[model samples]
Target: MNVCDYRKLSISMSYYLQLFRNNAGVGRTGTYIVLDAMLKQIQAKGVVNVFGFLLHIRNQRNFLVQTEEQYIFIHDALVEAIMSGETNLRMEQIQELKKSNSYLEQQYKNIIQFQAKDIHISAAMKQVNSIKNRGAIFPVNSYRVHLTPKPGEEGSDYINGTWLHGFRRLKDFIVTQHPMHHTVKDFWQMIWDHNVQTIVMLSSLDEINFAQFWPADDTTSIDSDSYRMRFLSKCNKSDYVTRDFIIQSTQHDYELSVKMLHYPSWPNLANANTIYDFIVDVHERASDYRNGPIVIVDR
Candidate 1:
């Protein structure tokens, strides 16, 4: 997650540990005395190796007590160090490290945010140029597989077999292939062998903009044309896209299109006055050579 969340967790853990230690009523000297007794007892039992003694203690209940006592001693010593102001040096060093880390994190975030904005702007400009030159804009690859309803067949089957299947498969692939899998063992070797981003899948839309995917309409049939329309509307409402439309009259039966001429990053364009402005401008420009007015409907 985020830095704020991590900081909160760290603070909570520290508070809980301190509370536990205070309730235990054990001091550094008392804990060490218990450990020393346990060590002597283990040695008297002919366990000459310290490592074996430690392991034996770890495996046995009485030994476990000694181990815990040792831990308490270390904890108490650390607290004593802090109370005596000796840990101030370490704390100062930590503060310096944290400040450096925060600066680096902010810089990294700024660079990525700038890159995201630039990518959006460049894509929008490309769409505008394509429109002006009467060239076709490349369609985004659908994460869904296409399926036509069989004669007298219900639409639900098509939805489950194609759209739902595709979506689930893609999600599963992403989770399994995500770069952070520790079991990967040789990530650098894999990276050198294959030219690909460490994380092959984009972060979930919900993670980036929860409002975009929240309030999902589960009542609607997945196979219905309106299902995808509703999904698009939610995404657009969160300002993820300028607008989205589906053309049913086309020979392809359905064509999903996103208006990229006006993006969220740049709001000064005269042609992009509103979410519907880009469509209106395109309609006006192609009026003489085109069909009827395209209906814009709410999901």
Candidate 2:
């Protein structure tokens, strides 16, 4: 099972105890008091030990304990769990300390340069290269999975990305850049042609000075001349925004559903508490579409 499903199955013990905060129909003001108290306790005596106390109390007294004070206590316990998202910060620190740079050197030096030997490649594809964030940066061919061009298009049709080979597969995932305004058409075209089911967007549209390639919002739709994209539904969580899009090919008479999980928080020290939360959510959601290729975009 994916992490989200596993957490759902074990909600009582997970980091989302807010779901149980008002299960007993407690007053909003009282709940806030309890929540504030729980936060103070967490700040004073570390979250792990405080969480242990809450677990013990929950085990001793059932979730629906009697008395308003008891109810407040249980609610406070749940609040404690919700505020203990500090684990995200801790895990990031550990990862940064142990992160490897071998792949960075290998890709930047060897694999990425496999096809760039011909400097004329970028000049050949005027529009794509001219609009790229980084000039002269192109995906290598040998390991790069070429995106299929639309009918009638000839020669190289460039959309900057490469096939990342995993231990047992020829193509594990496709790593690409955040889409530019001019390349939005090509971006959706790539997804339509490749049958990409999941797209994990790591950068915020506002930060990149770029227009979003997807539909405007849950209430609206957008078009790429050949395809019409409409927002079907959207779920806004604490760490990420999951938007469901239905894309119809005007020329082909077929429609496809796509999940675009956008993680707007780029993880600065200020919002470290929820950084990994969106990443984990995307990972779990992407796993649901394992049958098809995933397109991952970053800044």
Candidate 3:
């Protein structure tokens, strides 16, 4: 029988067998026995047909599996011969093909090396630019660090304390190094009031908690914008968050916004601290660009 017939028989056998077994005592005894026997025969035939079909499929796939390597080799040889353009029977044509192949191989290697060198140079340039920018803004004594809070927990003393202490030191250094137009508090207030693109709180490694520090009903205040107030929370192993939050926050807060910096379970926090310091330094130095969109770089 065809596959369709085999499937039909298989389904019928299963249904009849189940019904016969369940209703063995309730149904007429002789009728149940007969039906059970009929089901057994149908089941046997179905099993045989299914086995045959499986064997046929295995045989069909066997050829494809066995000859795959050979096919690949043949394809490669044909491609190489075509690329060499050595169809003619002449010995000179064969020699020319060999030379062409060598030239092509060398060209490929050169291209690869050139691309690698270009990438290395580009990376180095980025590093140099970052260093130059930071040097111009941050004083010698200013140091920055990152703080991440635990999931379901409000901002703790440890996280905020670490950040606050580090930033306070940085402000002191700046005051010592240069004559400031305003006190540190005044500087920070200016940043908060003018919507300065200075500090960025990225959602690295987890979904961050975001809330407004000021009164919720103060619509006239600049901080009324939900984007102006952002915080990050680190989650446990089973937790997850979305990238949409970052994008939406960026849109709402034209100056400072949050971002997700996905890091491996065992990550180096040193880089995060460095980035935070760089951002602060940049903003302190280039106060003119504080109104523009803040760019946060994360690895």
| Top candidate (lDDT) | 2
Candidate 3: where is the Cα deviation over 4 Å? 1-108, 115-229, 237-261, 265-299
Reference-based TM-score, model 1: 0.17
Q: Over the stretch 1-299, how does candidate 3's per-residue lDDT look in tens digits?
A: 22232232212333233334433332323332323333344446632232343245446444321222222322332333223332334666666667687766864654454222232223223542232221233211112211232366332101001111123222221111111222222223333333334333232333232222222232322222223343434332222221211111323434443232222322335566655654554456445443332323221
lDDT of 2 by residue, 223-299 (tens): 76567778888889776788888889888988878898887765442456566676676678666766557788876
> Where's the lowest-lDDT run of ten residues in candidate 2?
1-10
* Candidate order (lDDT): 2, 3, 1
Higher-ranked by TM-score: 2 or 3: 2
Sort every candidate by TM-score, greatest first: 2, 3, 1
Q: Candidate 2: where is the Cα deviation over 4 Å?
A: 1-116, 119-133, 151-156, 218-220, 224-226, 251-253, 269-273
Per-candidate TM equals 0.17, 0.53, 0.18
- Candidate 2 to truth, TM: 0.53
Summarize candidate 1's per-residue lDDT along 59-91 as a digit string, tens digits.
Answer: 543434333434543344333222232112355
Among these predictions, the greatest TM-score belongs to 2
